[model samples]
Target: MTTNNVRGHRRRLPAIVATVIATALTLTACGGGSDAASDDDAATAGAADDGSFPVTIEHAFGETTLEEVPERVVTLGWSTHDIVAALGVVPVGVPETWGGDDEGYSEWFRDQVEDEIGGALPEILNYDDSGELDFEQVLALAPDVIIAPVWGVDEVSYDRLSEIAPTVAHLDPENSWSSTWQDLTVMVGEVLGRSDAAGELVAQTETLLDDATQAHPEFAGASFVYGLTLSDGATELGLYIPDDPRVRLLRELGFVDTPAMQTVLDSVEGGNWYGGVSLEELDTVEADLFLAWSAGPEELAYTLEHPTFSRWAPIASGHYLFFEDEALAMATNGPSPLSIEWALANGFVDKLADALAGGAVTVS
Candidate 1:
């Protein structure tokens, strides 16, 4: 029974309806039907040609556009460079760190970005003690546009970053990493005049996700607990409430969460949020599949060795699952098109296969 303290870190979204309209426009941008009139039938294929119009977008951040291909684009926040690079637009600069240290970006993303775009790592722009973005350094980079999707930046940060260039923020707080990836890919595509490539990448990723999900039908009809434990031994259990992409993904696998987990899930109020319980109350989390995350190696060790923890029915029944930081992070935070396939290939597929096979292997 652990309280989900991490929910306190929930993203703050704009209350203004303007943000909603912006989101719709961004989706249209992603779908590849810009308002600009193009005479070339080839342009409708999501390509740029001699008749392509000058596209300028105004959003929550600010207004900016591309008369032609932008030379210097700056990507902000965590892991957006992957989408940009996937669309063949190498960012001139990106945040060296996502939050504080923590390797900031995923290994798969870093390798892919570096492989596609050869350049020095971008400057790290985050709070230095008092929680303030280094706007001066960002301004120095002089980027054509800024792509930020991971963290929920405040209005001030949004304004400042927008001043440098158009800054793309998360469309909705509840939306997962995959939504951010799709939105930013289109946003970057618009600026770089690579909408065709953007559409192709999105299509490709959709296909990959479809194939991966179809490969593991055993995951169907199972419910799971997706969450993390902090250094203080507190657990942040993902209730997998309705509308959450993870829950949606699980549903796609032909599985449903156990009634126990679903009970706690229904108890969540205000939003598709969570239920907080004490570590002593771990029994509340009831599911056929248990997936927990540790902040690091030490946390994981403590969880496995704890005498009281072994008494938990799930652990005792061998339904307990624990993931290292990497898998945990990827499962929750890495929601890109590539990420879905990566998650499947890396271990998710095998785990489902084993689960379906009724193997005695413990999920490590």
Candidate 2:
């Protein structure tokens, strides 16, 4: 059994710092306000004067105290931008979204910025394929604070970013991506002086998930295995652990993990979110339903026709769900208040219901 190890594989800070220094040398000194604020220009107008500031938040890289509500904010990592936007604070800089709209923004985020907030998009910071932050770009933004509660910010990166501005790293020092949506929202709210508002938002989103669970009684006690099948002709079947946000969301919807999933979890080391099982042993990981995401239609077609995958119980019995829409898949995999609402409105729950009805479904 081969394992796809993703833990502690991030590029060390010396290499990242060297790259940033090299990139900084070529860049001209431009004003930070060129594309920092939204069209409305009142970035902090929506922030409540709840006396939540002068707050110290403990994170993976020690503690950071915000003296006042952040006016010029910058967000790194997945979902931090979404959470900031959801809380009515327009960020000066945000990480570019992968599998998002053409402009490197999520559809829900774009709608919120353009239609709801009546603001222009923030500057999109570039990151490498390995999810390394562009330190030079972040430094150029001259932000008041850097929010990154769910990113892979190692000690060195955190210290460097702190030199630029007070930076918040992950909640757990050991696990880079362990913070749940609820924990992240509360932390963001505290930073923005909107603790009450954050609590309300959490409750509202949870209510939506609860409503779905109550509405779908069949999901109760059902077994499920969520994973991915590579289009690159890999010999292993990737599986997400229960702690993964996607699997946690499924569990919230009343699904339970299977013994096969437990086996995978038992084999996984700390800090890794996923594992893999050989295709030859696919039948051993049986469950009432199987779920996966495909890169596109061609990838889905390839998996369905693969000799070994074709014989898997879920595929043969038509009890499987596949996502062909990258945006929808991103919404579930990295959920936030804005994305969750957009997902439900755009048939995320319905797709699951259709799959649970005992037929293979490929959501487009």
Candidate 3:
């Protein structure tokens, strides 16, 4: 059995009364009626044809049935907005992205919205300083449906969001954030009544990855360990499990998991996507290539100089890559069709090639 470790990662929210009051005030100040109607029209105009109405979707929180094709949609998690927008539906509200561009949106998402979809950008539902989701903002949007297939939505939050609209939680009841990009795309397509389009998108993405693999034979069977060192003074290393999206993406690119990863998985006792290993035992988690992200240059330097970590095989042989660009890291962490295409168009593939060649490399 696995435990729900979400509370440790996310902050508890404020009381409902305060959230309601804030929602009312914010709506009143923004002339909610007219603005909402206009946004709704824009979103509806761009949406794909209505699928069979009254569709029922089973999720972590029982089941939710959509009586009709939804117009105004709200998304709460990393790739849901991207998938929705890619399927030709503009979301009315989307959770703020941490490594996003200046507008709290990913570059690919913005490009798709502005250049391809030609619609107004969705409102960003920002978390508070304490990492609390802005429930007030979500309520103010008055979305017809809420998509959160890979979010950390607990029972209380699910019930509350259901009161606002038909809310869909994560796919797995036992794991909060374990959905794959393909599954998410297909699910969102089903919700939007565009399964055919979703399938095509998936096929195209697969072809893109396949072509990359064929082009770079070196990636095939290349053992790797993807992880990160927290800013907590580099005391421990966080290794992503096989089920994690980041690791899945690497596998799709033709990389193989190191034998050490199975040992880490055996040690992990819960549904948590990551497991920790002390810096002292870093050498035990061996791999041909070590890919990771750092808080900054200082942290990277500290990790490289650490007594135990410095002696790790990959680091000693310079077969390691670190990313300082949060945007790139986010793209890889939860890849969508849009982000994958953008990443390839950028220099992500080339960077991997460089890392495989050997030498300490960092992408800033």
Where does model 3 exceed 4 Å of error? 1-39, 42-51, 230-235
User: Could you tell me which 10 consecutive residues in candidate 3 have the lowest summed lDDT?
Assistant: 1-10
- Candidate 3's residue-wise lDDT over 152-250, tens digit each? 477888888888999999988889788889999888877875565677778877887898888889999999998885564667788889989989999
Which pairs clash in model 2?
Answer: none
Residue by residue across 1-364, what tens digits does model 2's lDDT show? 1112121222221221122222222221321112233544435324444446689999877889998767778888889888777766678898778768678988877766665566678999877888677899989888888998776478888899999999999998778786788899889888776665567677778888888889889899989999986676789888999878889889988999977886787667668998888889888987888889887767777888889988988788888888766777888898887778777767677777777776677766
For each candidate, give its TM-score against the true structure: 0.69, 0.85, 0.86
**Model 1 lDDT per residue over 1-364, tens place:** 2111211121221121122224334554665544443232111112232334488754444455556544556766555665665553446566654222255655444444454333344445555778677788778767666766555365678877777876666545443233445566666566656665566666665565566667776566666665544344445333445455555555555667656665566566765445544456667666566556556667766765666665666556665455553543454454554445445545565554554443422333
- Given candidate 3, what's the lDDT at residue 324? 78
Q: For candidate 1, give the lDDT.
A: 0.52
**What's the true lDDT of residue 26 in model 1?**
58
